[model samples]
Target: MEPDQVLSVTELTREIREVLQGHIGTVWVEGEISNHRLQGSGHQYFTLKDAGSQLSCVMFRGARSGVRLSDGAQVQVHGEISVYEPRGQYQMVVKQVQMKGQGSLQARFEALKRKLHEEGLFDQDYKQDIPKYPRVVALVTSPTGAAIQDMLNILTRRAPWIHVLVFPVRVQGQGVEKETIRALEMLNRAEAHGLPVPDTIVIGRGGGSIEDLWAYNEESLARAIFASQIPVISAVGHEIDFTIADFVADLRAPTPSAAAELLAPDVTELKRHFESLSRRLGGQVMTLLDRHEQTLDFIARGALKTAPAYQLQTAEQAVDDLEDNLKVAAKEQLRGLGDLIQERQQIIVEHHPRIMLMEAAHRLENQAQQLQQKISHKLERLADQVTSRAQLMKHLGPESILARGFSYTTDAQGNVIRDAADVEPGQTLVTRLQQGQVTSTAV
Candidate 1:
């Protein structure tokens, strides 16, 4: 037995605080809170209590300002151990405090969600688009759960021809994370092998409390959903119950039944679309046939219905009628034009002269005839005058006088003697008579 040492309260508390300080500096304590108050300085003063004990907690203004706390709220606290010398007691200096139980789990979930979001793992770019028409669909869930049953029922009702593959997996509890990862890997392996691979995968479970749905919130499971090659539809819990898997999956359905409806097509809608297309095609074909028949009827009633010789005879008759009409019109027009010209000529004659041009031509011809008669008479007169003048000149000639009474005597050279003194006694002489000249010698 150790002997007890009596000491003052200050020393006793100081020793106690020294022992508590080491242990409390790094420990997690869980309790329900009370007497929570915010001081004027913005520090928090609260009491942590349990069924058998209570503890005083002080969060300073700097450390507790952003912390939201309330009375009767459950919490887990972490802090260092210290003693206020003035108060003469030991207390915890809280570094951090968090809501306990399910609230803590929710906070962790939100943190991881934001982290994965920043990495683009939960982005639409990473999500696979659901196939418009899935030929083979793979389902991942508890084999005995109602979710699987609902999905199977919906798939059969919507598209009976679609093939279904079941990959049994645990939807809750301890080993679920590995099973989910395994199931996705199996689907990928089947696809790589060219074996029967599912076009879409439905991964989900029925609704429950958050604890029952915690496995879906695991980061490992979320990563598996992100890495899957096939498009995934998450249908965990009811509509309001969301999990990390929902954000990472390609699609989120409100319920398990809705997920099945989304995975398959609507039979009634497809039938309606097919009927509309058929009606349009039938109408087009009928319209084409009707137009073809109309064209054929038009060709049958054309000019080819008549004989070639009859057509030629009709054309020739038309030409003859046209020629006769043209000739009649031309004759009438010519008669009218001639009457108009004659009328115009008569009017001109009455206004001016009856034969202006004819009178002028007659005058010209008469003048020409008078000129010819005058020219002929003048020529005959000129000829008679010329003969008389010539006869007078010849009768008065010197040779005529010589022939009458005198002789023109000349020498032997035949020169005439004009005077008696020109004669010589020994010279030969020529005498001019009316008939001829005679040559004689002077004696």
Candidate 2:
């Protein structure tokens, strides 16, 4: 007889798996990736290592969607760490993986930026050209900071003649969006009131962490920049930094100094261009003067120099003829304009509705007078009928009947009677006139 085995191999494997799974469920493991390889089946196999130890990790095809895993990439994985019975090796089956804390945020930021960029939020066609010679430039940033100082320095160096207007506002932290939006509104109001409008707006701060530069990520600030009538330049954070405002702005510069450079022309280049144009103009003028000198030399040597008086006389007669023609034309034009005005006036008078309005007013007055007469007649008739009815009512009044020495009598049945026979011998009867009532035993 063989020794009795309580469970089969399959059962034992399942039992061991249950125990291992129960003992070690999900855990967060932080490590650096090594030997990362994507399989033909699209699964990822890698070893996660800390300074002292390492564990083999497998990210299945399903869980690896939209995930980019590479060698030497630091990652924190959440999943079950179990022993694989087949290979008898311990490994981690990853459920989710992301770059360690701030790296994870950066990954999400990159993802969002890629998505928005693919949607054409960062298209060059949407970018507006910065004003070449802006009269006023509005700076939206912290009132007191190095960013402002840097921007001011660069602007003064580049465009010292252009006005650098400051709409002092908070660049980061809580309520920054509200204050920034209010600053934009104030600029709009200034424009509405005909104050010098900003030609281009500069909104940014210096380099910092994501949290430190979150104000530019606000949707309100992004929409404000998009809706601005003036062009906007977003220079948020360092060269590697980006925000929604940067994507939506008409232009984005890598730094505040870079933004200043883009906003104004280079003074040296402008001076060079001006000098070149001035030299060209001088050359052209010299060429034209030489030609004129040649012409004068020919004319002095020709016959026209001796006939100056006849030329003067002919020029004077032409001037007089031109003056007379101008006078006659002016008078004719004035007369034509007057006739047109008179014709328009006659048409307006013929089309005027004032005459019809007067007729309507007269008719309204007549109707009102007729209504008044009818209302008065109805009131007089009503008054006469009321007086006649009053007299008739007075004649039928009980007091008038009582004044004629008449009285009304009622028995126990409450029936009014004029004869004593109407009541029985023991019944009580009450008599009523306008003045009083008297009760008596029936006779």
Candidate 3:
């Protein structure tokens, strides 16, 4: 171990390996995986790298963790630091591997997605319909980014008529969600904010990592997009990226340029459409005018123009026929009136006053006899009813009750004493029997 002792290449590598294993030992490292390779022998080799440095790592067949090992995967590895003696290189002998920072962000994304979905924010019923032709469009994006430039170019090229309102906002970093949300609010109540109301609002940003695009995934931003009166088009990141804003927005465009293409109708295509319509209209008008001109030509060359005297003679004959037909119709009408008058006279004779008076007299005589019979019967029935009522009254009279031996007692004032409590012990009393009245006084 002395400085004078010479060491072979193998010995030096073995010594270095020992030093790394004993000193660095087993430790955990987090980085993005790159140049990942899975050997046919079931061993995996990869490089773990960050911004400044890279470390070679290898996981043997036996230590193969079930976690997916792929390039660009952000992962944390647990292993012992060791040097490969044969290659004279130091590397980590990885024992375990798992996802790192991106995994937690993904988990948060999924959880927020579930919460908003359960709240009906992602429901199609709540999604506003994007106008087919937006007159005014508000772009909420970073003015300095490639996204805004791409959108403006597309909007200007496709629909030059569209009024573009650019409300610059931070599309990334902390508090970006609040800025995006504020832009949406201003665009929704644009008139109140003294800004022209936009028919559509486009929230867009260039492609980035999930962390960079995390602002669009914010719950508040998603809710703001859901609450927006103006339809929102979410164009965050690439086509593969999905955020909560994409799910809650009225429409999801794959990119910022795609959102512009959707909002702005191509001027050339619209012009072609209008030109086709104009051609069709013009053809129809020409066809109608030609038809009317043909009719006029036929009239100009017809018999009415070429033979005026013959036409006039035919008109005189037609008038003569009409006069004769009117004569016949008038004679028939007079005959009908004469028959109607005769029928009326016959009806009047049948209904003469003398005949009606005789019939009335006969009916009156018969009615008089019936009236006398009804009056006699009524008087008899009334007499029977009176006799029965009189008998009933006699049976219920007070004289009949006195003859039945019922008696009554009264106080000196001649008031009937029903209850004994109503009379005084020393007061005068009169007892009325069926035949006589008895008077008594206190002793």
Among these predictions, the greatest lDDT belongs to 3
Report the number of clashing residue pairs per model.
0, 0, 0
TM-score of 1: 0.47
List runs of model 1 lying over 4 Å from the truth: 1-100, 192-195, 296-443
How would you encode candidate 2's per-residue C-alpha lDDT over 332-429 as one tens digit per residue? 99999999999999998876799778888999999999999999999999999999999999999877899898888888677887776666887888
Pick the winner on TM-score between candidates 2 and 3.
Answer: 3
Sorted by lDDT (best first), the order is 3, 1, 2
Worst 10-residue lDDT window for candidate 1 reads: 60-69
Q: Please, what is the whole-model Cα lDDT of each candidate in the order they appear?
A: 0.85, 0.82, 0.91
| Candidate 3 Cα misplacement greater than 4 A, ranges | 1-74, 77-99, 299-443
Q: After aligning candidate 1 to the native by TM-score, how far in Å is the CA of 146 from where it should be?
A: 0.5
Estimate TM-scores for all models: 0.47, 0.47, 0.53
Q: Give the distance in Å from residue 210's predicted Cα in candidate 3 to where it truly belongs.
A: 1.0
lDDT of 1 by residue, 68-170 (tens): 6889877878877678767886677777787666666878888998998898988887778898889999888999999999999988988888899988999
Steric clash pairs (candidate 2):
none
CA shift of 201, model 2, Å: 0.5
Backbone clashes (count) for model 2: 0
